[model samples]
Target: MDTQVIVLSVVADIVGLVSVILGFVAEKTKIKPSEIIVNDFVYCDYPTSSVLGMAISASLMLILAEVLIAIAGSCCGCCRTNAAGTGKSVVGIVLSVFSWFAFTTSFILFLVGAVNRGVNWQHLKIGDDCPLSSHLPGIFAGAAVLAFVAVSLGTAAAFLLAATPGSSSQYAQGVEMGRPQFQVPSNGTPPFNRPTI
Candidate 1:
C-alpha cells in the first residue's frame, strides 16, 4: 500500500504497454519476403523497413519498465528471513528471475528481428535468397508476448515486495499483554492518577 510502490507499478505498467504496442507496429511493418529483390549475385535489394526503429524503441521501453519494477521491488533475495515483503519471498524471487530471463530473451529477439527485417543485410550468405525471412511476423509477435510476460511477472513480484508485513513490522506492533492504566477512567474515580509500581 506504499505510495512509492504504487506509483512505480503504474509507470512500469504503462511503459510495458507502450513497448508492446511498438512491438506490434514493428511486426506489422516488417519487411516481407516478397519485397526482397535478388539482384543477380550482386546484392539483395532490401527495403528500408520501419522495423528497426520500432523494435529498438520497444526494447528501450521494456528496459525502462523492468528498471522501474526493480526499483520498486528492490532486489530478489529469497534467502532473507522476512518472507512477507521486499526481496525475501520465494514467489517474489521466482517472479523476478523469470521476468529477467524473459526480458533478456525478448530483447535479443527484438534486435535479431529488427536485423532480420532487412535492416541489416545477410551477415553470412548461405544460398542467399533474401536469407530466409525466418517467419518475421511470428518472431516479433512472440517477442511482444515475452515482453508482456516479463512485465506481468515483475509487477507481481513488486506487489509482493510492497506487502510491508515482515518481522520488523510485527515487532513494532509490540506485545499483546495489557498494562496497568494510571489515568482515571470516565466511569470510575481511581485512588491515584499515577502508578505505584
Candidate 2:
C-alpha cells in the first residue's frame, strides 16, 4: 500500500517482463555451426543451451513473483494480519532471491562459455575460414544485460517489502490501534495502598 512499495513493485515487474522477453529471444536465436573437416571426419561447434534455459527460468520466476506480490498488495490492502497476503509477500521475496542467484550464475556461465568457445575456435586449424557468426553471442549478451537489470530491480523490491512496517507481524495491527495509558493516583500512592511508611 505504501507509495515506495508500489513504485518498486511496478519497476521490478517491468524489468522482469523485459528480461523474460530478451531471454526468449536469446533462446530462439539460431546459432550457426562452424564445421571443421579433417581427413574424412567433420566436427561441428554449437552454443550451450543450459545458459539460455537458466536465464529463461530465472526471468520467469522473477516475473511470476512480482505479479503475485502486486495482486496480494492490491487485493488485501497490504494488511500484515492477512495470512495469505503476508505469505505471498514472503514467497515473493524468496522467489526474487532465487531468481537473482540463478541469473547471476547463468550470466557467469554464459560469459565463461563464450570465452572458452572463442579460445577453442582460434586454436582450430581448418583449411577454410570459420563460418561462425557473432549474432547469437550478441543476442545472449543482450539477454544477460536484461537479466542483470531484472535481478537488481527484483532485489530492491524484495528488500522494500521486507522492510515495510507491520508487514511481517500479526500483532502490528493491535499496536497501531494504540494502547491504553494508566493514570497515576493524585495522592502519589499506589492504587492498592500498603501500610503507611
Candidate 3:
C-alpha cells in the first residue's frame, strides 16, 4: 500500500471508531434521536418516472466523482513521487475539512436546539408540537459548502490528470475502447444511432 493510502486508512479507521463511540454515547444519553416521523415528512413531489430519472442522475454524479478520485489517486503513483500524489493530498484535505465542518455544525445545532426549546418538524394535522428546528438550515448550509469544496477539488484533480499528455492518452484510449460509438447524420435525421438519446 502507498503511504498515503496507509495514512488515510488509519485516519479513516480512527474517525470511524470515534464516530461509533460518540454515536453510542448519544444514543444512550437520548440527546439525538434517530426515529423518523413520516406524518410531517415532506419531499419533493413529482411524476412517477421522475423519481427514477433523478435517482439515476444523482447516482451518475456520485459515481463520476468516485471514479475520478480513484483515477487521480492512482495516477499520483504510489504517493511517492507522482503528481497524482498531490491529487490524493488535495482529496484528503478536502475530506478532513468536511469532517471538521460536520462535527462542529452538528455540535452547534444540538446546542441551539436544546437551548431554544423550539423543536421543528411538527406533525401539522396530528397536532404534535414538532417545530422544525432552526439548526437544520445551518447544518444543511455547512454540508452543502463542504460538498461543493470536495467536488470542486475532485473535478480539478481529474482535469489536471486528463490534461497531462501521458495520462490523457491512456484515459482517452480506455474510454474509446470501452464506450460504444455512433455516427450522426449530416441532414436532420433521427439520431437513434446515438444510444437512448
Candidate that scores best on lDDT: 1
* Candidate 2, pairs of clashing residues: none
The worst-scoring run of ten residues by lDDT in candidate 1 lies at 164-173
Instruction: Give the per-residue lDDT digits (tens) of candidate 1, residues 27-126.
Output: 8877777876766565666777778888889999999999999887766433223554444366777888999999999999888887755454643344
lDDT of candidate model 1 versus the reference: 0.77
How many backbone clashes are present in model 1?
A: 0
Name the regions of candidate 3 deviating beyond 4 angstroms.
Answer: 1-60, 72-129, 159-197
Instruction: Put down candidate 2 lDDT per residue, 1-197, tens digits, no spaces.
Output: 45555565666666565655555554454344533333333443444444444444544655564455444343223444443445546665555555556556545534443443322233343455444444345555555555656455455545545555556544643455558666779978766667878
User: What TM-score do all the candidates reach, one by one?
Assistant: 0.72, 0.37, 0.29
Q: What order do you get sorting by TM-score, best first?
A: 1, 2, 3
Pick the winner on lDDT between candidates 1 and 3. 1
RMSD of each: 11.1, 10.6, 16.9
Over the stretch 1-197, how does candidate 3's per-residue lDDT look in tens digits?
A: 23443343344334333433333332233212233344424421111122222222322333344444544444332232323335545554454445444434434433442332222333332234333442233332332243344444444444443333333223333335557766778896776746665
Q: lDDT scores for all predictions?
A: 0.77, 0.50, 0.37
Ranking by lDDT: 1, 2, 3
Q: Write down the RMSD of candidate 1 (Cα, Å).
A: 11.1
Judge candidate 2 at residue 101 and give its lDDT: 61
For model 3 the TM-score comes to 0.29
